[model samples]
Target: MGIDGGIGRLPLAVADAVRTGGGEIRTGAPVRELRRTADGWTVVTDGEVLRADAVVVAAPAPAAARLLAADSPAASAELATVDYASMALITMAFRRDDVASLADGSGFLVPPVDGRTIKAATFSSRKWGWLRDAAPDLFVLRTSIGRFEDEEHLKRDDADLVGMSLADLGAATGLDARPVATRVSRWDGGLPQYPVGHLERVARIRAEVAKLPGLRVCGAVYDGVGIPACIGSARTAADELLTATLAAGAVGGERE
Candidate 1:
């Protein structure tokens, strides 16, 4: 259940496994378009064009729509309608002696009604044993900001965001310590917003895309947004693609 190093190590492990299974992993290659060829698919990127029997479009809804718009208009339109939200994370490191006593738990979430800039905060060093052991004298913490239909705070400067987070931290936990280091990570249109007819829209998209051979789409836009949900959707898409491919081959063999 636990990764050896951290969650960041998962991509490398997955890439290694793919290589072992004779699949290539290309990093930093921006795909330009996906074209349906006579027999399979042609993935056109900035640098090269790769052909494959099956194609899984696992990008965000908008990006996937662009890729499939030419071929699958209905699915692309549905994907285009999927909404997204932006968020930012401000991580700060403070000298343990300078901060006030923290609560026993790892962190806390601020309700929207509180009218605070920070939505939530996590005591990284306290929550993760590995981080605490690595830097015992430093208190590493991060605050999340912005949410669906509320992204005006994200327009502020990084320093201002950090200051707001610190102010909220002070009010919430009575911690009035100045951080020695700070890092701000911004994600634009990061999380998808699932409105009321989301599942039906996803079903329609899947049905439309399934009409085309060797094409499949799956991601947070269609299902749950968590990592586990994304993985499950990917697995299901892969299974369906493989099953259809095998069944077609069997029918062809019988005809021959």
Candidate 2:
């Protein structure tokens, strides 16, 4: 789900859950290297080195491609084949009095024919109950950044993008007030496009990666890019790694 930046506390909730589960999550730690050692896999991030029996890489496709290209050429080639769309989120927040036409349901999705700046808009306050209470004076409007047909629209600067999005939102919701606040975030190579035969490509990648006993890749690029899909891929990768480890141990026991 695309968060409208209204539910500011949701990340805190997620962090608390991780803390409660005794899982330490680190931010700003960039992985520099992943190499196989005699014992297991070594991950070097920043100046810190960590060892694990298995690795599940869930980074974006381009970055993941660079990481795996040297170690597993076939998997890297598959990653390279996957395509992504560049996107930007233009959010404008207005007061309730500013947009009377904004209805109670989710905002509109502009069909390809609309020839408009926004691909979709979610009425932030109306779509989620938690968001409604988060900002009383604020009504959030999220406008999609880029479309397959409209590549030039994404070339605009933040100010231009924000203005275009506001114009579209105003037309759709009949809002006139200048937004109290506007923010734009560009996500380069963000949304993965699931082209025809994408499943076959992903299956081939998985088969190649399976040759590397402890290596796993999981992310929105594979399966589906939805929240559930990412979570499911992560879970499946973990399970597969565990199964492989156990099977290796069983084989070692038999040999012993």
Candidate 3:
């Protein structure tokens, strides 16, 4: 399931929750490395090194590999093996009456064998009731282009991408009207590919990450790339971290 309205407000919502819980949000802190300290972990950023009780490496595969290189070469190597795919989405808004009949359905996914440029299309206003209610006069739809190995078209400029999407859309669904407003968004190296033995690879990565007492890894790289899957994996990692921390604290209390 997708987020209602949209996911643009997600960061702000998370920030609000953090502030409500008395947590400070740090911006412009680009982490450079992860260092295991005696107390916990040291997060080396562009500006400073902050100590933490536990750390979660939720970055993309290449970046996560870079951060974990010194601490766990094995995990770094495994992460390095993860390949990424790029995609561009063309979101266009047309007059509701213009494409009234054409968008009756939720849109369709094009078959690769059909030699189509567009991988899939979503009738945004039709599929999402909230979007329809928000802007009933406008018919919003989006088309996604590019795949794991078929990203040559992605290098084209936004206009070219939009043109390509329109051409494919016309051929597939007979949409000939020009959009009133259009936007093109590119997600470069946004999706990780899972080849054969992916589960085993994830297991190996998790095992290596577990070697660090208070360190855990979670993201689209370790689990499915969908938002729900990423969230679920993160929750699981957090639960494990909390359990381990409480156990260690109990042991320390007994020792004292």
Quick one: best lDDT, which candidate?
3
Residues 1-256 of candidate 2: C-alpha lDDT, one tens digit per residue? 5455544566677789989998677889978787777656778788688877778888988788877877888888889877778888888788878787666678778987877878898776777666777887788778886865456788888999888887887787776778889888888777888999999989998988888878888989999987778878989998998898888773221100
For each candidate, the alpha-carbon lDDT, in order, equals: 0.88, 0.80, 0.89
In candidate 3 the C-alpha lDDT for residue 147 amounts to: 96
Candidate 1 stretches with Cα past 4 Å from truth are: 1-4, 250-256
- Candidate 3 structure lDDT: 0.89
Tens-digit lDDT track of model 1 for 1-256: 4353558888788889999998777889977898887777788888887777788999999899999998899999999999999999999999987764877788999899999999999988878888888888998999999999999999999999999999999999998889999999999999999999988999999999999898898888878998889999999999998898897773321100
Q: Which candidate order results from sorting by lDDT in descending order?
A: 3, 1, 2
Query: Per-residue lDDT tens digits of candidate 3, residues 132-165?
Result: 9999999999999999999999989999888888
Ranking by TM-score: 3, 1, 2
The local lDDT score (0 to 100) that residue 117 gets in candidate 2 is 74
Which scores higher on TM-score, 1 or 3?
Answer: 3
